[model samples]
Target: MRRGGDWKRGTVERPVGAPVFDPTDERGEETERATSASPRLSSTLLQRGKSDAADAEAICEAASRPKLRKNFVPIKSPEQQGAQMLARVRNQFIGRRTQLANSIRGYAAEFSFTAPRGLSRLQQLLIDIRDDTTVPNLAKELVEALAIELARVHDQIAKLDKKLMQLHRSNEMSRRLAAIPGVGPIGATLLSIKVVDARGFKSARNFAAWLGLTPKNHSTAGKNRLGVITRAGDGMLRTVLVAGATAVIADMRRRGSRPWSWLKDMIARKPPKLVAIALANKLARIAWKLMVSGERYRPASAVPMPTPT
Candidate 1:
């Protein structure tokens, strides 16, 4: 109805087909539900993405890692680590033994009693000195002290030997390697430990190079000059190899067998030290081939003869 020319108020109405709930109240409810679910969804998605990425990266890294030929294998085992430790211990004992022997000799020389050259002979001399009434009391006391020190070093060496023997029995490779000529318990144990894997080397030459057996080079202007072995690898192994070679060469000479022709010539031309080093290098190469091929040592004659030239 109109009153004094004023129009009547129209009715308030919502949009057609809209929900019947209050707009402000419905919006608040929807926001609360979304806020609660958002964190969990995001976290789940992030974790899934991270895992997938990590898997892909791992696969790629593995593919990128360096690999040898198909037949090559890497040494990766606790047994190898154990073998290395034993070698180190044995080497240490040997060094200590040498030091003690030298010290005993030097100490005895102060009293005008020259110690014998050999270890066993030196020990006997020390005992005789201790028992001799002719020696002054002060000299006798000093000799006794040196003897005690020598005994202590020997005990340590004995313990190391026991440990090495135990390892030799436990390790199949060590036992087999010991069967090779010139490779005693110490050599076998050290070799087994020091050589992590045969597969790491492509050939026998490569293995010998690792032991620093290959000749060193210093060449210029197309003139090739060679020097002594680099001696780059395990010092203990190198020392053992040299000592073994010296023994072999000595035995060969004693037996009057044809010495390695080169060695024979060198003995005639060079000093004893140089010849020993040369033989050591040859021995190292021989050892590498034997170990790599799992073959036994054969004398030159045992090898088949070449056809007539």
Candidate 2:
């Protein structure tokens, strides 16, 4: 309920001689020899409170439950943490790059020197502004400064992308995930970085749900009502999956290639955005199975994909 164990990430070590089932941390660990851990929820129905003492009491009660192991936060190695850090920084740079590009475009539009969309077009727009004599030199100077910053951000992103590519090449799981139809290098690398242990997920659907690819349930009176995707889990990972799915659909349409029957049917009935989300969900499930079972991907989806392990 507290939205994953992100609040407790980093610097916590699985002590050299600690039990795998019982991990010790600075604050607490659920072991007979030390303090028991209770992953705090957004709100404990058993006891709603606003003070530290009340929170501790609630945590103690929650830890008394019989099945608390599933809620334990997965500990990360230094390498895994570094990988996540790299991916996050790259993602941030990408966002900043887009923002800077848009700002430059908006400012350049004032001078009636608008360029087409796409990052490549941004550089050309800057060139046009540099050459245009009618545009005020002052405005040009400001835009030029933005362009410089944008270039710096772009260089940083490219460097990080190269590092991720190298990691993907060396990581077997990432390579296997990239084999999935809708998952490219970036999406595959994200899955590998985020999913430390595939076995921890009971099934493919659970993995998909964890990635926030599944629909939300709003059922009542024994009537099943499904809403839009919950959009939980890692926002960046989900976004990459959906973007990759959208690209896959576009390629399929442009080349007039045969898509999986279900995908084709969905495309026919659903709006393009909805179809992309569905395809992304399928990709997430497929990725989960590959990670768990170490199976090769089958492009032909007519043969059903493996159920989540």
Candidate 3:
């Protein structure tokens, strides 16, 4: 078995007593796993060799390995898939809205009008485009059409956001994870639905590494070296977590929240972006603990501190 784009739709039930192994194809670990499972060398391991038959043989061989069964990708429930689809659609609309906004701004700038930075200002830009007799009517009509589309997209996004909030409120795990700083409805629900079993990870560090928040190791001959994040799994999850961390950092900077002392100290030593990644990594761990222990997050201080609600 392989976890590709179609696996969610095309996957069939595993036969009785048949082993399953989902090749993490995007990570290029498919052939490696095959090699570990069988005596026959994978086509990927051979120089100047490739064929569909060879690939099938490799998969057949790998399926016989007793250790391969644990690597199967978790089957997501319809609700989980729905939530993920909602988030994805919301993200798509957000990106489209941004593109439309920038297009409007760029058009306005050409006419010596500089719109203020904010989505709320797009309406004013539309007004300016329509009323500015100095501007051509054709350009005005096109900009108006784009503005209409943007408004519709915004409305759709708002509806999806409400749905996501509903999900966050309804799911106990999502609520518990949401109690952690830098873990909001989006982040919490994403993890709650996407991660089938948090205990499958041996430790918090493993969870963070799976999320690709930890630094990459490149040590040799007793010389230790580390690099940027490996970015191994679920790029969208990592992105949202980092975004939540960024919001937390901004709030800490504005309100001087004491609960974020660790973030502040890290900022003093490292760059703000680096601090955000570090905070996201820690948030991943906290989320894992909440999932495994089935406990709500308890803030360290009595003071009312501001974070994602």
Candidate 4:
């Protein structure tokens, strides 16, 4: 069937035991929209025509080709769906909160009341503005309202954090995944829920490529060329992984933590943001290995302390 509004509703109402196939076009864009049903089928057949009936016929014709059915997207369980929803909601609130904070900062700048960086500093600035006699009453009231909204978003995010933490504790796989240096409760839980079976990927590199962490290859003849990441898969997952990598790099730089000597040298030579992307690619490979092998990470010993001269 052509997967659309009414069709989607009907597909969701199908018997739980029945087999359902979701077909993606050549671009592979509709994969995630099929959270309930699967295995996914890829075919150029669906692109034959834009009409609903033509699309339905194309799906039927595509189903007949055994070669086209080789690639299938795995079906996600209800639990995983719940976790994805929670993550999406939390992400939405984070964006809104940032917008409100920026608005507060922008408006205050017009009055030459520049606040220090960071959320705490912004909140404090709002309080000071509220009490200052020189500030206009209308401006004070507007800024106060923004502060209240920002506080509300903060409270909601905290509630989601508690929920994610509970899920992280309950799931053995997520807890095991949290053993990785940069991975926290949110990243662990998201990975567990998003990737049902890392073993399905043929190799660690394939898994990293699937996450779009690997560089794009454009090779012809004997010469080979590479470009930036494809940015083609699970954008939210990729974003969080990069964010975790950033945090790890920042902490290591500040504390001079004893990471591998090669990594230290790379950090010194490369731009920090580029290093973070590279680290995130390595982290993806490590997570794939751990997931496939069913082993928790074991940290290497810290660099040997120097002996007294």
Candidate 5:
């Protein structure tokens, strides 16, 4: 089934008693692009009685539809899949490191040892735990174990970071994407690999919407209501984009000069988090344009230079 049309959109069927669900649902294990049941192509076919033949027929029915052409996901090469695996492993290691650090912090706090926030402060707390005579020896040993595990995780993450950076340096498209203000090596590389075919998206807005950066639609007759982001795509990708945007805004604030007038005005009027999401959405759209048009980023004109005093 995979050989001729693995990328084709098709229907998913579960046991007869099971309730139907969207294959592209955000809560599914990983994003639906690779592991999808091929929903949008045929989510509306909820025929309940499901045998293997019935499922195949349903899939065939969906694939036969002309509209399914618009809904297909890109078929990733082996190289792209490998890059995704690396990103995922690195993400897992980073998360484990955070978990270990938090556990160490909580344990040390119980024994009246504390350090200010920040991962760097964790090492100092670990040293304090090792040297403290008043704390129970058993607890000290346990905390030391956690600290050691955390250090190992940190080293692994560093290794993965180095490898990902090398990949970024080697890819022309990734390098082009890195030119965006918020997107760095990691973000650029991720976008490059995950979105292998830019034309799969209808437009830049569609690309941003696919990433779930857009507001949820709650429109009624003669009225418009927007809610939080749909948050409907690969969670990691969205997180990377948002984090990059936050760093950009933070730096702009620290330096006391907005790079663009619209950003300055928005920051003045909107909440910082909301501004970050907006900026992230813009970044996704810009990335899509770069991928689709094969054009390098052309930054918008900056705030006018101050006249010489």
Candidate 6:
């Protein structure tokens, strides 16, 4: 016998002509029919089986998730770290040395013992004050302590400088950057480390932006406005660039060359500070291009001129 157009079960199956009960028949009957007819519903059973298999597979995969591997870049070696640490310590010492000298000078000024304003004059001033009978014993003691601290600071800086020079000799990248004018040992070392991948930037403009040398923008509606530099990148690098630019500017002036006519024009028109910052921005861009291209810096005249119209 057959039921719902198929044969099933050991008991006599209901005939196809037998009264077909609606699924929405009395609650108990519907439930009984649904339970009894479940196995006969081959399509639904297969679908449910497939769903269970899929869920089990998903759970197993989740439970056995692959271990994640760390991909951290290699850290600096112990020697490099040591060198950097020494350099930092030396910088701090130099700062302390300056502070000590300044404090002594201030103290001397209070006693009408004015010393010339410069580090070179510091030792002489200290000596003069120490030898003077007019200075109180307490003041002399303070001066002596400051002098000792200054000497210690100088010693530390000197030691660090020697270590830095050794490192610079071993570092080819540092040496290459150092070849650039106005970039000394400190500048070269810092630039090499700070700019790990010069090619990370696509263009010189992008490099300049990375160094926060790009002009800031403010726009509303269809109008656009440009202002000072964004100052959004490595502050230390930016500072070094400014110092380098200032040195370059001074050197150009001494040589009777208008190296950065744009800066000179800006200085004539705008504030000195603005002109300085602009020059720094130009310097940073120039440095970026030089590093990325592995090219030597050439003055404007040395650079090939475009074909004239």
Q: Whole-model Cα lDDT per candidate?
A: 0.62, 0.78, 0.74, 0.75, 0.78, 0.63
lDDT of 2 at 274: 93
Question: lDDT (0-100) at residue 239 of candidate 5?
Answer: 97
Worst 10 residues of 3 by lDDT: 32-41
Candidate 3 Cα misplacement greater than 4 A, ranges = 1-53, 60-71, 259-261, 301-309
lDDT of candidate 6 over 131-177, digit per residue (tens): 89998999999888888888877887888778778778888777776
| Backbone clash count for every predicted candidate, in the order shown | 0, 1, 0, 0, 0, 0
Give RMSD to native, each candidate. Answer: 24.2, 7.1, 8.5, 7.7, 7.2, 23.7
Q: Name the candidate, 4 or 6, with the larger lDDT value.
A: 4
Give the per-residue Cα lDDT of candidate 1 at 44: 29
Write the residue-wise lDDT of candidate 4 on 125-216 in tens digits: 78778878989999989998998899999999999999989989999989988988788778898898788678778888888788888888
TM-score of model 1 relative to the true fold?
0.65
Q: Which ten residues in a row are the worst by lDDT in model 4?
A: 5-14
Residue 171 accuracy (lDDT) in model 1 = 72
RMSD of 2: 7.1
| lDDT ranking of the models | 5, 2, 4, 3, 6, 1
The better candidate by TM-score, 3 or 4, is: 4
Off by over 4 Å in 2: 1-52, 64-71, 300-309
Off by over 4 Å in 5: 1-44, 64-71, 301-309
- The better-scoring model by TM-score among 4 and 6 is 4
Q: Can you write out model 5's per-residue Cα lDDT over 219-308, one digit (the tens) per residue?
A: 999799999999987788899999999999999889976456667778899999999999999889889888988888876421243333
Task: Report the lDDT of model 5 for residue 63.
Answer: 62
* Model 2 TM-score (2 dp): 0.82
Most TM-score-accurate candidate: 5
The number of clashing residue pairs in model 6 is 0
